[model samples]
Target: MTEHKPEKKVCVFCGSSFGVDPNFSKSASELGVLLSNNNYGLVYGGGTTGLMGCVAKAVASNGSYVHGIIPEALVSKERKNLDEIKKMNEELKESVENHRGATPLDDSYGKTTIVPDMHTRKRMMAQEADGFVAMPGGFGTLEEVMEITTWSQLGIHAKPIVLFNIDHFYDEFIGFLGNCVAKGFISPENGTIISVATTPEEVISKLQSYKVPEGRFNLSWKNQ
Candidate 1:
């Protein structure tokens, strides 16, 4: 039997923590609500903490389908009870529970698949998404987005890769990509493939306007 697929699924890489800036969580929640309203299924690391938890909870609250792929090693370890934030806002308790996937908190919010490792989790998410969104995050987030971008550069897939540069969160990383081009590591033409967005609308716009590279998947430098 064929697998059932949604019209569009976006794999989002974001911080497991909310970060120091309030804008991060705000943007994440907004993006989640907006994506769901636009009928896009959300795929991400299954952590109910930080910005990851914020986005997932918002998506769930807005009545959208959200799927999570997390490594079994991190499931029990990462999805900690965020008591500090929970106490700050009484209403957030419900959101927290929803992310926890606790009984009575589950409401067609979608499924969570616990994989064997991080590699498996990422592969599953990539397989499920038509596009990728990277929010402000630390090392893990950067790693996820860059891997997808590298895959695209090599023509592994034609899916859109975007940076949700909320509050200019990704400015330095964007510059780093340019630096790679300057250093002759990445092609200038290939660098244009990355779409940077400041808002949710821009994220969709970039995805809609994404173009596939002309050449097929390959690596010239490695062979030489």
Candidate 2:
């Protein structure tokens, strides 16, 4: 029997609005291109604006499959970047046919699944991704990264969660984590659970070398 393994898919969490820094956007685009060229699959929010759209377009341009799962309400708004979506959809079609050795769907390549609500969208995105990366973003991006990182700390998942700290956007947050450790909020060991990288190349390399810690385990009932 022939064994088939699915390609590794990375979940990218970023802002729907572009921040003031051009470096962030450029890094996002570069990461997308690198992921595609490196044979890494992508799962992201279906927003075709800001850093989200930038990354998606880069990946699709390089002929990689990007699966975007978005909420129903935001679907139409994302339509503005239809040009990139169109290219991604086409690339997805070719990838399905040639790489996966499967029949391609009539569906467009910027493959998006419109979920009923934000909760479902995030859940589905997390479920589909084998790993995660958080680029420069606002509240939503932070929420996604923190939730997944929390899951990692709880021992519920062992997937690597990396920070795409472009332009030092996440410096304050990283410093807060240290403060948490110093104040006894988070364990010193737990502080190292999340990896940090300043560039796309560093992020990719870190993810590739990531391995689950040997002694990590879930918590037990409180002794109190």
Candidate 3:
């Protein structure tokens, strides 16, 4: 008899909003489908709108499990679409009516379980996922990705942190990391903490091959 390996769950951090570009949303949906087809579960924020919702919807439609973590206060607020912000009040009213009685937007549009708060959400997702992938997002997304990267650098965790650097959104950030290496604030070798990819297919390939090294380091060198 042959034994089968369990499907690994991946934590994906991405923008709640779709932004101005259609490519971002398209890529997000593609990633969801890929994860589902590969038997991978998704761990993400709980919302029924934006890029978050798009990814969640794709996974659920493909019959995969999704785990969503969100702060309690932001649950209702986060459900509103980002583009809705630019609309006139009258236009917003008309837009809401147009989509009325449509799919009852729920966390499970992608078959998800929602958690509350940032701390709890991060902890749970970190614990549950076999790896992590970060798509383009704003400040909140950057914070989440940084936290995971820090954890990996400290040897507190051993999961891959893949960056979906769509549209060169992360180009400047990558440059800043280089500056850190040059200034002696971080070891150039620590740069291995993340893998950057321009496409969803590359992101998956990087995650599958990532391996974290053993041991943690102190910042004594920084002081010296």
> RMSD of each candidate?
8.2, 8.9, 9.2
- Tell me the deviation in Å of residue 189 in model 1: 1.5
Question: Using Cα atoms with residue i matched to residue i, what is each candidate's TM-score against the true structure?
Answer: 0.79, 0.79, 0.78
Using TM-score as the yardstick, the better of models 2 and 3 is: 2
Q: Could you give candidate 1's per-residue lDDT for residues 1-224 as a string of tens digits?
A: 12234479889899877788998999898988888777787898866677887787777777777787756454333334435423452211223222334322233445566567888989889888999999998889999998998888776677998899999888888999899989998777887777899998898789888887654356554421
Q: Name the TM-score of candidate 1.
A: 0.79
TM-score, candidate number 3: 0.78
Task: Give the lowest summed-lDDT range of ten residues in model 3.
Answer: 89-98
Global local distance difference test of model 2: 0.75
Model 2 RMSD, rounded to 1 decimal? 8.9
Badly placed stretches (over 4 Å) of model 3 are 1-6, 77-108, 111-116, 213-224
Residue lDDT tens for model 2, 9-82: 89999986678988888899999988876788789886566787788777766677778776545434324444
Q: Please tell me which model should have the higher lDDT, number 1 or number 3.
A: 1
Residue-level lDDT of model 3, residues 41-60, one tens digit each, is 78876565667778877777
